[model samples]
Target: MVDGRRITRRRFLQDSARAASALALTAWGLEGARGTASAQELSFPVERGASLRVLRWSQFVTTDRPIFEQNAARFTQRTGVPVRVEYETWTDVQPKAAAAANVGSGPDIVIGFFDEPHLWADKLVPVTDLAQYLGRKYGGWFDVCPQYGYSPQRNAWIAIPIGAPGVAINYRVSWVREAGFDPDPARFPRTTDEFLRLCRALRARGHPTGFALGKAVGDGNTWVHWCLWAFGGRVLAPDNRTLTINSPETANALEYARALYETMIPGVAGWLDPHNNRAFLAGEISLTNNGISIYFAAKNDFPEIAQDMNHAVFPVGPVGRPTELHLFSQAYIFSYTRYPNAAKEFLRWIMEDTQYARWINGMLGYVSHPLRAYTNLTVWRSDPKALPFRDAVARMLPHSYAGRPGPEAARAMAEFVVVDMFADACTGRRSVRDAIRAAEDRLRRIYRS
Candidate 1:
């Protein structure tokens, strides 16, 4: 984690008070057909000589970085705003953003993942004007899009969600058939019981699967949350105030995670996010949970592996429904930005169909659009392997699992409470009861004050 991102309660309340003014201007109405903010209303004219810097996580699909840099250069070409793009690991992105948000002195815009905005919405500029403008120009956002960035206290978006990377099972078709399971993507294992059996068969065939069990902010959290929700467990009460992580359903899920980890290749209890990506690419395993980045990596570097590998929906739980955790790609324009209008202008340019479509094509299937209209981007339909993930952003629930998001939900995600619970049980670090109790205790502290 980036150093010094933690928020003390006194500091947090202070920032929330400071953050209210930005929201107060547009707080009157946020839901249903609202009037758009014109370039004139958002105020500052695009400062011609202004320079804007955006800090973002390193690209998931790898190839998108250079393509994005090229796009940034093009943005500068059209507008006079000079742009500099910086990259960080997914693990480092939020903390760095937190550091910047608290200090009010970094990145004109920063890439935010999980619930970063929820944690520091008070410190970030409201983007409702920009969001609504984009919605009017390019069609509206998906139903879930606003929740990731919306500030109920302010009644505005803390950040405009750009997109999300959907988490799903990435399996080798050839290996599945070799292990005596149907290789057909359409007929792949749909239930948790069938998924477990297939993993056993694949393991016996010497292609054991694994997922990151360490504090992988994205991969570990997404898969663990999926398992927990699949088994009828959730992290928060409907109130978003009470901690509901310790339950019989949660224990059942933990038990399932323990069994699932046993089917994985050894040493997964120590793996990080990139470790499994490297493992799968090295042909060390047959199946794992991941986004389309793995697919692009295989296609670009290991064509034969690409041919063998394909995507599948996250397996259904015993509850007869599947739960997917979408790792969102959201960017915030900081309140401290000197070039607010220029920064907003740059984002608007980036969202335009021509610019955004080109960028989406370059990413392959790594990111799905936050808005429903952009679902027609054709990147998914062009590649059959990517089609399964087209609806990732549309189907996601908040990390808190219930009710509106807040600092409490964001803190729970950043702390990786659910992930640690499963890892504790799976790795023998703690019994299920002890693990759940430990998680509950930690959450109590997070939700306090």
Candidate 2:
């Protein structure tokens, strides 16, 4: 059964690749339409006699999995090649891939998060050449895509963003209205002082604001990065080389975070991503910052709460309103893949416009096309059911910031700064300043080691 919207083959492969690269183009200050390559340029000499194995997030595939069986059947029929897909979660997949690489049995294709390229640098094949190939086949790379997964020092494209989960403020419109507040743009809090006042007002009216502070890496790290940006703290220097988390601005940010923590629900320190989502869904909290997936998850399971919840662009911080653009688990090809060309072709196929629509729509609205052009589609941009989310993305894109690129630094920040310090501050085990200072010391030790 055809499950999603479809586009022509040429439009699927060629146009999509060009569109994907558009984000990178804009980041580099380039201007042009995407996908101007002729069909002849995209025609590849097929090496049909190759077989490949792929490993991906286990939730996306299964052996007894009916979905995997169906998709694999179609893939084999289309390519005339044997294919195997192994599935595992991020925690399981990384160690498995590492162990497999050591034993020379790693899968040909690997799907990992944006940090994976940096985390598994030794195992990755710099697919930076894919940009050139995309240019030849489609037209040119987008401004944002290249930046998301490329490492300049490594001179390789270790990963490609298949999707992006933009962050935003999720609030209950019903509660806000009942609390005698108009949260419209003109009246919305734009500064930290105003935000605090609003939170106090909401609290007086019995609406507690929720911010993710759980011990899980996903929510905890997100809290640190988003709060830091909101408070005008720089995680790294402009050159992407220096750790600037110990700056005065960072201290100020941490202080603000501590104050905000004081106003949050009592047990927020123990709540992870799902816990925060549940808090909002169960009407325990009024406002929180989270990924678009939370909305999808809510809408899928509980339509009543979904209708009451609305999304807004994160309030502008002292420096500016900076939202986190989270690049979730993405796909990559392994250097050890025996059929690199075929693997690339498979990637190209899946990323093609038609197949992309299937993958995305099938995911119950959890995924978003990373490119602006694709995001401009009717389903993404104009759907009435998604208007709030679409508006959130539009407002966030210009001011979006990414955390430290590599997994090592990101993990360190999560383990040290977020889980240890921030969580402690929330729970009153340590003051914010002391926690941040301790985190800085811990980070220095980590990097030095």
Candidate 3:
């Protein structure tokens, strides 16, 4: 057992491969459009003798990879097109996908993180037909769903908004109870002011808490972004034309993070996505923000911790509602595919009701309902433990906040601008005003271009 809490391979490598695609795209650059047509008539990819390739991030929920492969195998049986599937760590998927887009060859499809479809809109074929088909089969898209893949500029869907994996506050129930709060995860805390108070209490009881402060490909930037929006702050206004991050609400959020930093583990300044999962499982931390992988890991490897842990929505902020920016777990069909029809067919099948239910059941709460209609899957109602993560899509705010998610917002988040702003203040690299000024300056430059 590492650090006295048993660590499983799932917890260890889940995000190991999730959500770094856009960051890589930022450094190397390339990332998609929106359409909602339901016509599936395709003439290319010659249905007979066509083979397909699919590449996706290896999931934190260990069961997810195998579940997808099983469905792919079933698709091959049904369609006679042999499918080749490969899994990359989340970090590698972006760069690899970018390379494919750069050369105009490789996998027919990919699963990438948020705004990624926007980043590579120029290189992707619009999946309006597939998206519209699924939305009708399931319920209509979640509010932020269209923003992820559909761009009004091109009047097409550059990529499909497959699903979103939401991040929330994962904590040890026993520790919170010891801290004098009710043990129920739902009642834990729903406001920033109270969340900080809970952190101090847990720290006093010997289980120091944390979320990554460094540029964690996923978790680090996620929590930082949460704090920003919680206090009536946003990186951009609704129009996407003006920068709106330098405000009193933004400063209040940063100051709250500064206070939170003091109560966390000493090395969080350098921590990334996996650190919190490892820390919590090792019994080193009591609470933090993350997906359901923590409880999933504990259930399999550290049973006691499993019983003691649960995931919760972010506490209500000054806005008085959870402005959760659910992580993007979207799939895209690349324009380079010779088997475009076969690739689209595979996606359509995997997303259908029976197969979608099977895939989600395997991951349990690790993957939340991407579509509002898919919310009734047995996984949420079957297991009481999975209840808190069920409303992930419901709690979401588009990653761009009030602004439309497109090139400008995509560039800002991909480069981790707002994340750096909060990190700088917490790490003492910049005062609150300077950090906000620097972020605003950087965002203005991105939107101006």
TM-score of each: 0.89, 0.78, 0.88
lDDT of 2 by residue, 270-307 (tens): 77556777787788888887655556667777788778
Task: Give the alpha-carbon lDDT of every model.
Answer: 0.81, 0.61, 0.79
Task: Give the runs in model 2 whose Cα sits over 4 Å from its true position.
Answer: 1-51, 58-73, 82-87, 90-93, 101-103, 133-144, 183-188, 385-404, 407-419
Task: Please give the lDDT score for candidate 2.
Answer: 0.61
**Which digits, one per residue and each the tens of the lDDT, describe model 3 over residues 1-449?**
77898878997676455446434322221221112343344322436778988888877878988988999999888878898898887667878987898898889899888877677787787777676666655655665666676766657766766676668788888889899887686677877888888999999989899888776767886788778888889887887787889999999999989999988998887887788999989999888888888888888999999887877778887888777777777788887777778877887788777888898888886777666667888888888878877887776787788888887787787688987898899989999999999998898889888
Cα distance off (Å), candidate 2, residue 171: 1.7
- The segments of candidate 3 whose C-alpha lies over 4 angstroms from its true place after superposition are 1-46
Candidate closer to the true structure by TM-score (higher is better), 1 or 2? 1
Best by lDDT: 1
Most TM-score-accurate candidate: 1
lDDT of 1 at 105: 89
lDDT tens per residue, model 1, 1-449: 22758888888899898677435434422332222332233334787579999999887776688878887899888776789999898889888888887787889998778667777777777888878766655555665666676788766777878888888789989989998999777999999989989998999889999998888877898899899999988878888777788899999999988888877988888888888899999988889988888888888889999998988888889777668888887888888887888887777777777877888878886888876567888797798899888889877777777655778778778888888888999998999999999999998898885
